[model samples]
Target: MNDRLTAAQASRSTAVKATLDYPVIDTDVHVNDYTPALEEYVQQYGGGELVDALRKVLGSRFNTRSNGKDWYQQTLAERRYNRTLRSPWWARVTRNTLDLATYTLPALLAERLAEQGADYSVLFPNDVLAPLGAGRHRQALHRAINHYHADQYSKYSDRLTPVAGIPLHTPEEGIEELEFAVKTLGLKVINIAGGVKRPIPSVADKYPAADHPEVAKYAHYTDFYGIDSEYDYDPFWAKVVELGVPVTTHYGSQGWTGRHSISNYMYNHIGHFADGSQAFAKALFFGGVTRRFPGLRVALLEGGADWGAHVFTHLLDRWDKRNREAVHNYNPANADLELLENLFQRYGKDLIKDRTLDKSTLLLDSLGVSALPHSRDPNEDEIDDFALAGIESPEDIKTRWVDSFYFGSESDDRTVASAFNAKLNPLNAKINAIWSSDIGHWDVPDLTEPLAESWDLVEQGVITAADFKALVFDNPYRFYTEANPQFFKGTAIEQKLSSSHTK
Candidate 1:
């Protein structure tokens, strides 16, 4: 037994120990069963040329030759374990013992929750959005994926809030899916890619011959492109605010322009999101979406927070000037300022005093700063581990070792809170930052480990406890629930033990 214990222990012991009791709500994690899930939906519904293209793309990634099995069979065998593990309604109905053990029964997640004391967790689909947007799918295929995610939510309840995936080929179709997602699936979040195909101009506008210089330039930039445009998204955003659902852009793995010229994978994928998201945010702001539907909220997932801060400041500066110019435009004839002053005398107080207006302003203030957790690949574990532990003063330990499990304790001990406050002070107290452990991504280890590491950073004075809480619990809770109050009930954990419970 002693020899076996020694053999079982390896170099990863310290790394594992350091993360054993960190409380966390992993906002990003994935489960991929792409080929089978896509194929089954396609085959059962209808397989057209688009379906064929989907098969070819997915087959290249998951299908193998040695087995000589059909794509569905091979995919099923490979992904059966993960599929069963997912807390989808099918799993619940079938009572897959493995899924029940791992996800549904709360045994697997609860163990981690108990150790780290995590209050809640939100789940996003890996196979759905990453591939769904790449090609066109039959309407039925879209319905199947949507239904599958809905089933996941029904089975797991708050433990997994499945984000809905929309087919963006047409604005009408996007709206339809959005409606079903909220009404049928009870989906709180909607995920759309950074790209959508633009509409063609009318025949009369086809002007100069096909070979015209202007035509060539236009085609090079906009022709047959599958990039998402802000104009096309107006209707969708309108409905989102009406229904009170937050719109999220999950950065797709594939590049938008084309595969060849793209240099770094991260830069290509994340760069497109940054460019697209910035444009999207600008359109919503200037297009008067925020002004129109003041209650609406938008979240940029996996996109870093620093960029959001930069963009908000830039927009405020620009808007202030633009508003001033607009006032000048209607000046003397209408006496714009005096007219506004007269109007203000009549309605300004009423408008400013309205509760809804106040709420909308607050909502915009919160969304002006969005964020994702700072992630370091597990390969850099050593540096991160050392940094976390080194925060403790030797003399402090003489009294009692700090309990890293408690949220915000590390931040308080190491002055991390003060630093975060100072950095965010310029945003006019509109710091809508949240902490997320993009856990379950292949690059990240189990959730608890990172939470422990974050605490270590707090101890080292890298981040504060209040900021840590905001990142991990408070911010996400407020963003998901407050932005759209009806969708999420705060996280609740219930435990059930079997008559003959076993570890």
Candidate 2:
């Protein structure tokens, strides 16, 4: 075998050995574009020219060009923001290549599991959710994508678990899609964009609103929103509690327009997109979704963890004051405080009250946060310190900074080995942190580097090996399966895989 292959095998063997002891499950991995497989479905159900136009627009925004010698591929950034548009040579030599399947199923999955030593990898589509919020043929597009994914999941049932995507243009459609994903596809998880895009009539133009109350019924399938919110999602909280499904949201593709004057410029700005994800998530948390559904577990993907620590603390303080002020405003004779306390007690009865919020008078407890480890790509080197703050309180941010550093390294051996060997105090609640590879994006293809980097953190005494395993495996399995017993059962996984492949 080649040197690279040999190293990869060794890594896989090591991962398997580790998992045999701890049972590692990777919560966030991805399956890239299945357009070819779903072409038939698209032809039958998909909108034509508009979809093509959409693809062209998105592709132009991110696609890269290769030089004639096949030696170097230039990404969108390298094109000098489309400097090629002015060149006559561009049309002849430059072709926009958007290859979603750079990492094929069997090969990529096998390699990743072997490299990371994960027992199972929860797979999602890299492009699907981001595009749905555009509100054009959202339902049909989602159906076609899910059908394609279901087929792939069946093909590699042994290693891959697929989370189906649901369209939420209408509340009823969201509910229907959820039922279908769980019952027919056996999808334990449903991937949702945090906000829905609906056309709103205005004096000048019609635009989309990120937060909409009508979208909440879909929460019955999963409580997670792409962004965190306090208002306009109460029905969602109610349904989530009733159904008991944890929500997983990730950062990518905001369904927004008008931020940039240039259409192409808006699409190319990664920072703008990240900001939108952060903003939407903040809105949800401060808006009180967690307070409403305290039992709910929300997992943020791609977006790093540092901001979560800062935001959670800030929100808690705000809510505490809000509760106290409300109490003061009530008349003593009316027993307003007592009535409010009784309601709080009633809500607490159903919510999983975390110790962090026990002393606070606010109704909602703090939900946990998961961090995405830094990318393995040497080109992408900067690790955000903000993510490291996620595991600790805001006051402890400085003293506990070391812990965050230890937890988020890209080296798997250092992170996992050290975590395994470390003497962890049970009082810390086992970190409740997990790693998502953000695979299938145009950028990240393999888990080897990220997993290895995480391990390096462990080996360097940054995080304990136990925490490494929890980040990679244990927590995700518990997160999805624990919320809904029927969805995560072994039979469901196997049956879903079998059915998809047979098609």
Can you write out model 2's per-residue Cα lDDT over 166-202, one digit (the tens) per residue? 6655556776766666667655566666565333334
Error of 2 at 324 (Å): 3.6
The per-residue C-alpha lDDT of model 1 at residue 371 equals 25
**TM-score for each prediction?**
0.57, 0.58
lDDT: worst 10-residue window of model 2? 87-96
lDDT, residue 296, model 2: 58
Task: Count steric clashes of candidate 2.
Answer: 45
Q: In candidate 1, which residue ranges exceed 4 Å CA deviation?
A: 1-24, 34-38, 47-53, 57-117, 130-138, 199-234, 252-263, 266-272, 320-323, 326-427, 490-503
lDDT of 2 at 139: 68
Write down the RMSD of all candidates, one decimal each.
19.1, 16.4
